[model samples]
Target chain A: SQQGEEDPQALSIQEGENATMNCSYKTSINNLQWYRQNSGRGLVHLILIRSNEREKHSGRLRVTLDTSKKSSSLLITASRAADTASYFCATDKNTGNQFYFGTGTSLTVIP
Target chain B: GAGVSQSPSNKVTEKGKDVELRCDPISGHTALYWYRQSLGQGLEFLIYFQGNSAPDKSGLPSDRFSAERTGGSVSTLTIQRTQQEDSAVYLCASRRPANTGELFFGEGSRLTVL
Candidate 1:
């Protein structure tokens, strides 16, 4: 089970507030990726942080990876109600580009 | 396809029946993957194929689970004698060789075994 685990299984916040989710994995990884899934929809890749890098950002999303701690965090600043979704962290440490996804963090932003 | 595509968006089957889910990856994507998500659970790694060859099938839960890719494009996952536990959303994703970018995903096939 190379599966990563995301903490704060569920989070609720108001619009314009920051939402943060953490993920921890058990093995070395080439890269870690975060994805957002709207209900009943396919996942949308949000960001990917390489093991060698500590942080990366895309739009309002900021991702930080701490390899020494084997963990990562995703921060959505100034979140909107539209940002509500299930966030998952996936690690590409297994063979054949296979990914082990975390249990996910369900975020709900109130309007 | 513009993106990874999966067929039979929803399926309701009786226990002990066989079900086949299909995936059509984005054009020219060489890496294909199959994953499962039980309700309210994390994604479960099932298998991945590189250019029509599956080098890793370790995540498959049992003999009843199998997957294959043909023409290096489309893939199919077959579940035999599905139990209630086999019910889940099967997701497909594809990426280019050596690319660490985002993996394109399909909407997924939701299976419900009664």
Candidate 2:
């Protein structure tokens, strides 16, 4: 079963706009990580937010976690045409080591 | 390898045939994972391996799917008697042990079952 489900199955926005996607999970997680996929090949890790951490940032990426709500969100600042891709959230359950991924959010950035 | 490596960037097979996908993780990484992604779908966790412990196979969709890791370095995912539904990209990733580290992934093997 998928542990997380991302909102806004697909989104379209002009370049330079900020894109935000949300993921909701069922159980407590050791960490929540976001990834990007281009052309549906392989995923590239963007940022990881540990359970104890409420938020984290890396370059143009920002991630926030709310354990009480069992949800996380990924924010891409200043989105570019190249940033158009599918984004997924993976949660590592605190009860186990396995990571479960959510159905991705497909973002289309129009140049 | 500097990053995770997967074999046969693409594979096309007839239904009912068996196929094997291989993954070689970065040196010394003690954790590895395999996932399947269908067209326009998110990754479905298939299996996970950590060190020499028994793998977590709970996510495998069926008995026809099996994976094994050798020497904690390379891993193989074998799908027996493939079905049309098995057509998807198989991705492999590796991460450091017992840490909140990011996973390093390979350019997945695209499987086409006809």
Candidate 3:
């Protein structure tokens, strides 16, 4: 069963705009990580936020965690056409080493 | 300097036929994982291996699916009597044992069942 669920199944925005995607999970997690996947390719790790941490940033990506709400959000600022891709959130529950991924949000940025 | 690598980037197999997919993780990484991604779907965990310990196979969909990690370096996922529903992109990932929270993924092997 999927432990995480991402909202806004699909989003379309203009280049240079900001894009935000939200993910909600069911259980306590050790960490929540986000990944990006281009068409017909593998996933690329973006950033990871530990359970104890509330937020983290890497380059143009920002991630926030709200354990109380069992949710996380990924923010991409100054989005570019190349940033158009599917984004997924994966959760590593504190109890298990396995990670469960959400259905993902497909973002399309028009140049 | 190479990342995780998977063989036969694309595969086409007839129903009931068996198939094997391979993964070679980055050097020195002791943790490996296998996942399946259906079209327009998120990743589904299949198995996980940490060093030489027993692998976690709970995510495997059926008895027909099995996997093994040899020498804690390379791993193989074998599917027997494949079904049309089995067609999906099989992805392999690896990370240092202490950093299992973050995974490095391969290009993935796309399987098409006929």
User: In every candidate, what fraction of the native interface contacts is reproduced?
Assistant: 0.83, 0.76, 0.88
Best-matching candidate per lDDT: 3
In the order shown, what is each candidate's alpha-carbon RMSD? 1.2, 1.2, 1.0
> In candidate 2, how many Å is residue A5 off?
0.7
In candidate 1, clashing pairs total 0
lDDT (0-100) at residue B114 of candidate 1?
100
Writing each residue's lDDT as its tens digit, candidate 3 over B1-114 gives 389999889999999999999999999999899999999999999999988889999999999999998888989999999999999999999987677477999999999999
Candidate 3: give the clashing pairs.
none
What ranking of all candidate models by lDDT puts the best one first?
3, 1, 2
Global fold similarity of model 3 (TM-score)? 0.97
Show model 3 residue runs off by greater than 4 Å: none
Best model number under DockQ: 3
Ranking by TM-score: 3, 1, 2
Error of 1 at A84 (Å): 0.5
Q: Which docking category, incorrect, acceptable, medium or high, applies to candidate 2?
A: medium
The C-alpha stretches of model 2 lying farther than 4 A from their native spots are none
Supply the DockQ value of model 1. 0.77
Taken over the whole model, the C-alpha lDDT of each candidate is 0.92, 0.91, 0.93
